[model samples]
Target: MLSTYVDLAVGLVLAFLFLSLLVSGINEGLVRLLSIRSKFLWAFLRDTLDGPDRQGRSFLPAGMRDVFTALPFSRDARPRHNSMPSPAVLSPIPEGEAVAEGELTERLYERVREIDHPKAKRTSIATLPPERFALALMEFASAEPNGVQGLLDKLKAMRSPLHGHLQGIWESSAADVNRFRQQVEVWFDAEMRRLTLLYRRYVRWVVAVLGLVLTLVFSMDALEYGKTLLRDQAFREGVAAIAGGGDQGLTALKDRCTATGDSADPYRCVTEALSSPALVKIFDHALVGVAVPQNGDPQVKWNLGAWWERLISPGHWPGFVLTFAALLFGASFWWDILRRLTGIRSRAGR
Candidate 1:
């Protein structure tokens, strides 16, 4: 009786885990489909360059302008990349025509003061008017027209993902002389915002439909399942036994379980201990309650009519709602919960 009880409890845990893993796999696909994580980061970078007022008013050095232009959206009306012809380009100022250091530094320092940049590196040269900041960036640009790419190459060598993005921007925008800062700002920032919202709404719909399908396929009606769980006293007791005896359960399990740890667990050894017949039984039992039609079940058919009947049947509505609600908790939530429960149960068995 005790052995049979252990089998049932372990089977229940496995079933719970199976459901969680299914949800996790679908969630991963959904995240990638929408590029949900990367969108915010790209958006943040767009805002940083465009400034709050929607103007091309950032105070970075002018030589670096090409780096920002190639990203996401650029108004570069000219042909771009290696295949296309070049548009109008900014000619670097001749060496002699360029402002001398004392003059340039003074202008830069004054501009820095106007902007009130936090780090004061040029306290000795702040005698000029605030308008020199633009002049300073332009002069800085003129002084080293080709230098920015060299620095960019060095940055690329670092192999960081963000620097790689910067390099890509530079390559795409280097010959793009027609589209200026304002165009890039509008495309990357304002227009991208609309696209992001629309795509996210679409993703939500996909997740809902997917959730309902998974719910029905599993025959996991929350109401019926809840009754099944409640009627089985051993099942409830099994859950409690694995859930850990308050806070000390995990600690106690660790002390007692000589063969189990985070990197290793004895539960896997159960399979090794099983005979071939026992293994077959475990496998067979695992699929016993799954929704897929079984062999020779003449009554079971999943044709369009059956699907329509399932869809319209009021009896399935509560379960469908429960399933979608479970989906809202998401794969990560269930996985984490299961992981904790697993540790608790595995340790308790020791």
Candidate 2:
């Protein structure tokens, strides 16, 4: 009886893991859809562009406030489109030195020159301190209609087509060039913080909505599955057989029953049940097509609609909520737990 209960518990956890993997995939896809990656890049650039020292002195020339622009990024925002280079463009140039990590200065200096003056001699700007790096940008932009001046001119010239997060701030700062950096910094800081909070909030909303939807779709009523295990002796026997499947790996797990922390990590039972062919049949069959009563009873086509009805029936919300709440633990947490269990179980088996 105890073994049967253990089998049931492990089976439920495995089911949760499967659901988590799918839901997490959707969550990550939504991040890309919303361009969260680009938002993060902009936030990071807000700090990097400022460099280490900024006491009312910087590399950008006088006309910079007119055309200062945020670095272009995101899947849709091509680096080659804007005067500012995108993060994605940082790559090894053939017949040249490999740009190492933490060497953004070198990469930017090399890349900007390539765009403006392809034949110019490459400089060792990457090793320079942040202060010098700023000067490098200033010098590079010093050419007629200087680089920075050219950038601002481009922004002005293409005002009709160009739209960016930094564009408005730069345009507005044209009135007060002296305090432009301070005002822009304040605005950038606030916007970045807001984006951070917004991203987190949206993620939770996605998880909750996704969890609830999956619960309804899969008939993952924790209460119902538990009740089914307890009420149906045949089902309990089948699940227990899965949990107690006779295999060398499982036997090793059993042999380690008394090993330290065995109770803390019930990997043996979980591993056996997860590997069970019967468990695979259960989930696969349920997910692929309209489900029907196992016994093919009359007036009992257990299709998606039928499950939806049962899900909305009295006392079903609690079960659905429980399932959804369990999913809030997320897939990464479960993976870490499974890894720990594997280690402890292996030690005990030895």
Candidate 3:
């Protein structure tokens, strides 16, 4: 009993220690993989862009006034000069109004060059009206062979206008680049969050499984100990005492006399009857048939057998039940703790 108890205590302690170590390891791994500087930086960028502070801000230049002047006009705003000739329409066309397609391209190219220059102003083309520049570029693309590429080359060669329009394009392109970068950051943050959640959940599952394994191991050990205790000679003796002394009581009470035939005295006949083989066989068969019969008084043999059957055999069932319950509870508790640690709850809800 002493050895069994000691073994059980040691096993319990070991199980606890193992569980603690497992949990600690899982937490450390999670932190290493998910908690890093890059993740924080991306998160910061995402939050900054999503905030309302930078809205309606223009990062564009000066001296580019005429470039954006006619941009706000709707596409249909152009006068139909040839639709209906009238006496009122005899006014001479302004030189600026009759500018050729090629001249417009050259002017646009010069403006782009001015905007791109290092000393160019920082103003937004979008703020001035994007339609004019868009329309001009579109008209230039239609009239030129190399599209925007041809226009870019011409703008690069120009000395005047100082790449101002190109600078505007660069600013516009920068905004696009920034916006794209922000999107990438947001996506990265979201993916990290997702992976972190998944890892946490996985850790929880591992903990639960580990705990269950520990419980089963502990319970089995306990059950084996209990079985050993039940089978111990000293324990059996105690149980036997409680069940009452067997066979000897019955033998002491019965007389060895009384026979139906061939006896000189009743005592002798009783003695012979007591020693009869047929009678012994009958009693042995009767004992075997009954579950727990009370025949006059309990004998030592009967007491021992009853004790073994009633006390020892039934103890195994309760032990098994307790062990199974312990394992189940351990598994459940481990799973809950793991879930909280990993941030899996939020992910599950989403």
Candidate 4:
């Protein structure tokens, strides 16, 4: 009986891992499709270059705030920024022209804004590396014959927080370009860490919504499945056998699909592996309940009607909550638990 309980626990973990992996795959697709990393990088650049106004709002023109998303991944990136500042904002000053004492910040803002230019057919805000950003800033600041020294002179003359910030980086570099570049890289990394937290917050909400949708769509009632697994020994044992082999099987699939040298689309490869016959069989045996049609019961079809009926039932609320919460813990968490449970089951069987 204790062994049976362990098997039941393994089965539950296996199911949760499966669903969590599915969520992860879908999230990966969304991330790629939306260029989420690029968006966040652009946000970091925008906030850094624009600084803040007296009102504590971004110093960037109000119309250009969402320029981070004003790329292809955004909805109507072109049309949305029709009211943005004109090309003159980003146009570089002619050579040998007199640039203002503290105009480096303004120039930096213009270069960033160029990434969101509406008429530019090839503009893209790709991920900006710290080294590349530092190089660009250094080059932009060296408007006169004096290179690094001229850059430092401009930074010292600035009146904003950026002035103090860059001045500190300059002093720490001992007037060396390479050291300055390294210092800028460190600063960019720190700023990017903040961006990561903001991005994760956005992804957490996205996952919650996606988890709820998938739960209802698939009628994955955790409580009902738990009851089924506890009561049905044959079913429990069958799933536990699969769970015992879970690690090897999943690793093989992940390698063949995602880690292989030949596979072009890793996401599609993962989806195919997950939907393979063996994994499908695991789900088929596990989701057995009223949702499963009786053998030779022609009138009872497992269709949308059945799924919707199961989904809306009030008795499944506890199961729904449990399932949703489990999914939020993610695939890696559940996979670890499944492995531990499998190990325990193996030891117990001996």
**56-110 per-residue lDDT for model 3 (tens digits):** 3221111123112221221111111222222321221113335332333233333
- The regions of model 3 sitting more than 4 angstroms off are 1-18, 22-175, 220-350
Most accurate candidate by lDDT: 4
97 Cα displacement, candidate 3 (Å) = 51
What tens-digit string does per-residue lDDT give for candidate 1 at 181-200?
A: 22334334544466456445
**Which is better, 2 or 3, measured by TM-score?**
2
lDDT per residue for candidate 4 within 1-350, as digits (tens), equals 79778867887888889888888899878766655555455444544543443356542223322332443244221112232453432333333335442244345534454345443342244455566667667665554456666655544443334556677887888978778878988887777676667667767777777888777766777877877666454433444455687443444444555554675564565444343423233333232322333245534234565556766779888898999999999998997798677754545457
Off by over 4 Å in 1: 1-20, 33-40, 50-209, 216-219, 227-304, 339-350
Report the Cα lDDT for candidate 4. Answer: 0.58
Evaluation by TM-score, superior candidate among 1 and 3: 1
Q: Residue 339, candidate 3: how far off, in angstroms?
A: 21
Candidate 1: pairs in clash: none
Displacement of residue 260 (Cα, Å) in model 4 is 49
User: What are the per-residue Cα lDDT tens digits for candidate 2 across 72-186?
Assistant: 1211211222334435333322121332222433334444433332211222111123333343433433432534444344334433112243355446767343344455456
Q: Each candidate's TM vs. the true structure?
A: 0.33, 0.44, 0.21, 0.60
By TM-score, who's the top model here?
A: 4
